[model samples]
Target: MALLDTSRTAPGKGVAPLRSAAKAALEASGLPGRKTEAWRFTSVRDLTTADATPAQGGLVVDAAPGVDVHRLQGELPADVAGWLAAVEPTLPNAHFVALNGVLADELVVLHAQGHVVAPVTVTHHGAGEGSVSTPRLLVVLEPNAELTLVERFGGSSKGLTNAVTQVRLGANAGLRHIRVHDVAQASLIGALGVAQERDSRYRSLVVSLGGRLARLDLRVRLEGAGSRCDLDGLYHVDGQDHVDHHLRVEHHAPHATSTQTYRGVLDGRGVAVFDGQAQVTRTGPGAEAHQQNRNLLLSEGARAHTKPHLEIDHDEVVASHGATVGSLDEDALFYLRARGVPREDARTILVHAFLRELLESAPTPLRDELAAALRERLPRGEVTAAMELALDVDEAKGDGIEGDA
Candidate 1:
């Protein structure tokens, strides 16, 4: 792809060799086609044929207290460089990631040494039309440290934003990650990789709202015993938009647990896809994993593809996976209408309730913003004070709900 513009000088000491390696890998694998197994449901034709240029804009970070943020310019940290190098050779679909390594403007790293009470926000602003932005991020949490991270992608509807994020959690560490994609006419393809240590916990909430073509590949490995993970996602699509989310979680240690829940709302000619897999290795005895995906089709032209898979190599592991696609509950709508509620309002309410479960996983402030955004897109586009109060109560319920098998 001619889009690989290596004009921007390499930024760090060990980064040049890494970029060379990535460029080689990208040349070898190239862009995925419709025949690729993992990408069979999604297409990258828009990305390959966009005639795009290298994006000029960089990322902005609002660093939280107790968290150290660094922009890679000169010498790369040994650990960060090592991690980046290791990731280049093993990724299942390494083209976009290799593209990131080849053309990314800079690397943004967030490190937490102790508990961070506030949230760290990283905003990616894309360049103008006919351009492509490759943003790379790495997060590291020290032993017993706690942190919350928010990653937002937006701007330049006519551009392509391809991002890669890597996370490492030390023993007893905890990380709450939130990703929001609202780039209106843009094409977004990204990957997230995470590794957790003993007693560590990782929780993620992904919100996908707008894009012509948006896809995310998320992979998490629970490498240490007692580690746990929760993955929750909500996607809303309308007017010919296409969105896809593919996730894989590996339970490699004893007692490791994970749960994945995803919901989507499609309207008009919009389409959505959810492919999730949970695997328990032979060593992961006592592992518990569950996954569920549901889609609400809002129109005759709307469509969804849902696939949930579970692989268990240990007889002692507990695992279950399921997916459902259908329209809103007719019975609930009838009940609401019989109670004198307007049909459109009733449908809106049910849609909100269907998405509320996953929205509850977002932070309260973000939840409010997300609720307002979703309300604007739903039918009637109205929200009452009582409805807001009810959402408050739901948020107050916190993360106490059971998420595992």
Candidate 2:
């Protein structure tokens, strides 16, 4: 049975020329199911019936100064097959990638050949209720160039947003990516695909807070020797919110290294899932890969599912992956309580301790914003001092992160 009937559907705005191929890809992969190894634990129901209209009731944000933000305005290249062949052919068969290729709105392109002084920011705000928005971003960093890119998504509207980002790094180039999303009970699906060249470096920090339904998939390939990638994420969901993180890292060249660290905090009846995989290919003999997923559940109703995978097809390589799901540490809680702290304060202390590492490691500009966002979600005083104690409240007096929402 076909996963999707791409028949009778005209090609979307940007990918008009590749309608048939896109449809074929959709049919080949179909929608993943319980039996699908990659998607067995999570459900993408919200995305299958995904709406493509603009969302309602979200703040319109601004990009940093002097950065050119333009639409894909022109037609795709004539030799589209060559472009498709640049990336893996399996892209179409991946979850919603093909559908996105056919349905996405104009893609936003960010290109730089030299070092950029300030970070480039992209914002996704709600346009109305039950409306959907598909945003696409293409980033290219020429060899020896460096830049920072920030992605922010926030809104209270009831809608769905499916976003895709494609990145290419030339040899010796570097990139820093920071993505922060704080949504209401809305549906969200996002995918990021990256290809790195020799000696290139890529680092990403992702923070996701309470959402109705949210899923983020990250696929990174170290295709060049000595290339490196570092991925870190923080997720906090409560009140029946559902969030899932799917990550895959592939080491296809020798002397490559990849590291992943993700922490999640779930309370109320909310549920969270983390599935991360690391692959070391035969060509990658001197590869080093590490992954860890740690989750904390604050209430009996809260739930978490975690899976960490490592596959090595090389003779000389080092790889490790692990997942931990448990409530606050009772020993630490007891220690705090014995020190005269109230029960609530003790719990808060333990929770903060669990999250402190990633929060503190976040980019400087976004740290305070993250602390504020987390504080707002917790019941007032769920943590003693909430803002002042857990985070550096004294410093985050500014209105926002460089006009970010």
Candidate 3:
């Protein structure tokens, strides 16, 4: 067996010391194979084999109000490097982190000083055939500060993307993060790691709509009392596409809270997977955690795998998790059918309704955008046509005999 596996295969670039560090980390943990419980359903075979290329031609982002952006031109800042070290060292996919050291080009450090109502958007789009790019971003929030950070991903379907994001929050800081992956063609392997101090808060909303194979890992460490973390996600896949999301939250201090909720719609031969874990240590007294995953498969060939784990060590902590994968409710669909709703329209309505339950809590403007995007991405089939006809019928009827049926 080769000792230097995918984890240690670092492209020769960057400084020698940094490269050596990456190699050492990868060699220590090694790449996770099929047997790894966290990665059981998703495969990194394509990523390991892709001659990782540095991507070009992505979105241009500038500093927003109340935010300071450092576009690092040469050396990595000490503060940024320290944060990265803290995160990637403990990451399960640290091999990818080491790989990121060589392939990454876009380096930026973002600092939020005061409250900022406007969002800072970073658009990352790739070009060229089978190109690979690593986008590295480090974010820090000073005590009592707040900000909104948005990331949009685009590019070709055959292209592979490796992105790493590191974040740290001072006491009482807050962050609202929104990530939109609207590209229908790109293959993405990305990770975002966060650490929170006392009284801080972190909220993240992830929307995934494209990619031949898309996998993301999110890790949040609550190291302070009164800190909170909330994660919400919506994903849809069709055809032969696949999407996987892995999330982990560690509560190392008392009085911390976290929530993980995600929903998915799969059709055609698409596949989706959700694996999430929340751990409360003995020190994490008064911690509260909850996780839920629900998926709808429209086609017989579509698939979803959901696993939720909650580990608690303290008696004062409360934690629970659940997951379900099923088709649309036949009873509900029957009621719609009886109301003269077309089968296609009924199906689309049910899928959107399932997603809406989660989206309702999102910010109004973002909620509207996400709803529109989901509507556009819904698979069109005979039932969709039937829905359009149903709409036309509703318009002609004029008389509102609509059943709450």
Clashes within 3 Å, all models in order: 0, 8, 2
Candidate 1 per-residue C-alpha lDDT over 1-405 given as tens digits, one digit per residue, 9 for 90 to 100: 334443442333424544776767766885778888778878877666656677644588999889988778445778778766544422445777877777766778898988999999999886568888888888889899999999998865588888888888889999999998887888788889988889999999998895787889999988889999999999999998889999999888899899999999999889898999998877546799999999999999988989999988658977888899899999999999999988888888899888877777677788879888877778775743356666567656863234232
Root-mean-square deviation of every model: 4.8, 5.5, 5.1
lDDT tens digits, residues 97-128, model 3? 66665455446678888897788888777544
> Which sequence of candidate numbers ranks them by lDDT, best first?
1, 3, 2
Q: By TM-score, how accurate is candidate 3?
A: 0.86
lDDT-best of 1 and 2: 1
Supply the TM-score for candidate 2. Answer: 0.85
Model 3 bad stretches (over 4 Å): 1-20, 56-59, 85-92, 380-405
RMSD of 3: 5.1
Q: In candidate 2, what are the lDDT values of residues 251-300, reduced to their tens digit?
A: 88999999999998899999888988888878646899999999998889
TM-scores for every predicted model: 0.91, 0.85, 0.86
List per-prediction Cα lDDT, in the order shown.
0.81, 0.72, 0.76
